[model samples]
Target: MLAYLADVFSALSELNHSLQGRELNIVTASEKLAAFKEKLVLWIKRVKRGNLVNFPCLEETVTENSTLPPTFVAKIVEHMQMLCTSFDGYFSCGELQTCNIWILNPFMQNLEDVDDDGSIKEDLIDMRHNCGIQMEFTNSQLDHFLASQREAYPALATKGLEVLVPFATTYLCEQGFSCLLHIKTKSRNRLNSEHDMRVALSTKTLRFDAIMEKKQQ
Candidate 1:
């Protein structure tokens, strides 16, 4: 049972890392989450048949003479089912399902299957044919692609933006909290937190050498 839990935690850690990225958008997150839930369903079925392939340590410890207790296997299956349910309850949204259709890669999707009016379908067809648009879509992130298309394809861009703009995880929020903890220490409690936070959270690097040269002049 311990080995089983350890394996489960390992998988969860990977999933958590995958979800925690600056560029993670709803489209990508929904895909990862759906894949994870499918894996859980598979694991539940395998576990019932005494398949310990996923849990290597458990498999190693068990011999042909040894049998897995029915109650223990039942508990493990129940736990996995609960995890699947929790994930479905949290990430299951109609908008997420809709975005899963084509925003990730419009070129790979069938135009007829996309749940949009004729304009979006036209935009997709245009995007598929245009060499420059195809190159941009291939090189840029989904959010960037949608943003760049706003002028050329207003309706498509708007729909994509509705899915892309929302944060997929609480990573940024947690990062801000951690930054605040570092910035607003007891010694610096009375200091101006706003400016300090702005500097700390900024992705831009300050050029100290340039600043020094200007100061000397």
Candidate 2:
């Protein structure tokens, strides 16, 4: 399912890049959108089957892309919204209605105890909002879902349940550096050689592991 999501995201990135400088057409965008939706449905089905639970609902809201034609972007957004709404209580968050099966909501309710300054609460709200807009599940929800799924499909769900947060955090940090390099180098250049990039990434990974170990202690 993770691989499927990655593939869909890659496709979306490709489509976004392809649409740049080209006049956006509904037909062309719709074709890409349809493929994306199909992949999403397949992903959901796989997740549902692996977990032995009913699929969670998904909702997508694309803010207007002014660079593209309004009609074209609107059509794509509408299609995404429909595809997202087709699921059950899987991914809904914030103003988009809560999922009854969400185990993370309880944890989130207790955030006040952990976050006396309220920054964590604010960050969670933002994360939930983004999840709604992107038609993707929250990390909390995903964690709980995978954990529960592990009970039903031990082999399939164990790795995800164990590593979801660490994996996601690592991915985000890597992507952040990737984005920084892209903008600084204009995506047409590389500041470091392949060996240097690997060394830097390895250093970051070791640092993260050490920090996590300290936290656990």
Largest TM-score belongs to which candidate? 1
Over the stretch 1-217, how does candidate 1's per-residue lDDT look in tens digits?
Answer: 8887888899999999999978888767877888888889888899898898877777877888997899999999999999988887878633445534787687888766786654888888888889998898889988898999899999989888887899888999999899999988999788778888887888899897998999994
**Candidate 2 local Cα displacement, residue 93, angstroms:** 24
Candidate 2 lDDT (Cα, whole model)? 0.43
Task: List the global CA lDDT of all models.
Answer: 0.84, 0.43
Which residue runs does candidate 2 get wrong by more than 4 Å?
A: 1-11, 21-24, 51-83, 86-217
| Per-model TM against the reference | 0.87, 0.21
Report lDDT (Cα) of residue 67, candidate 1. Answer: 73
lDDT of 2 by residue, 1-217 (tens): 3433354456567755653432333333444555555665665554433421222221122223423344643544454456566522332222211322122342244443433342334444454555442243444345555565454345434543433333311344555578557444656465555655565545344566777888994
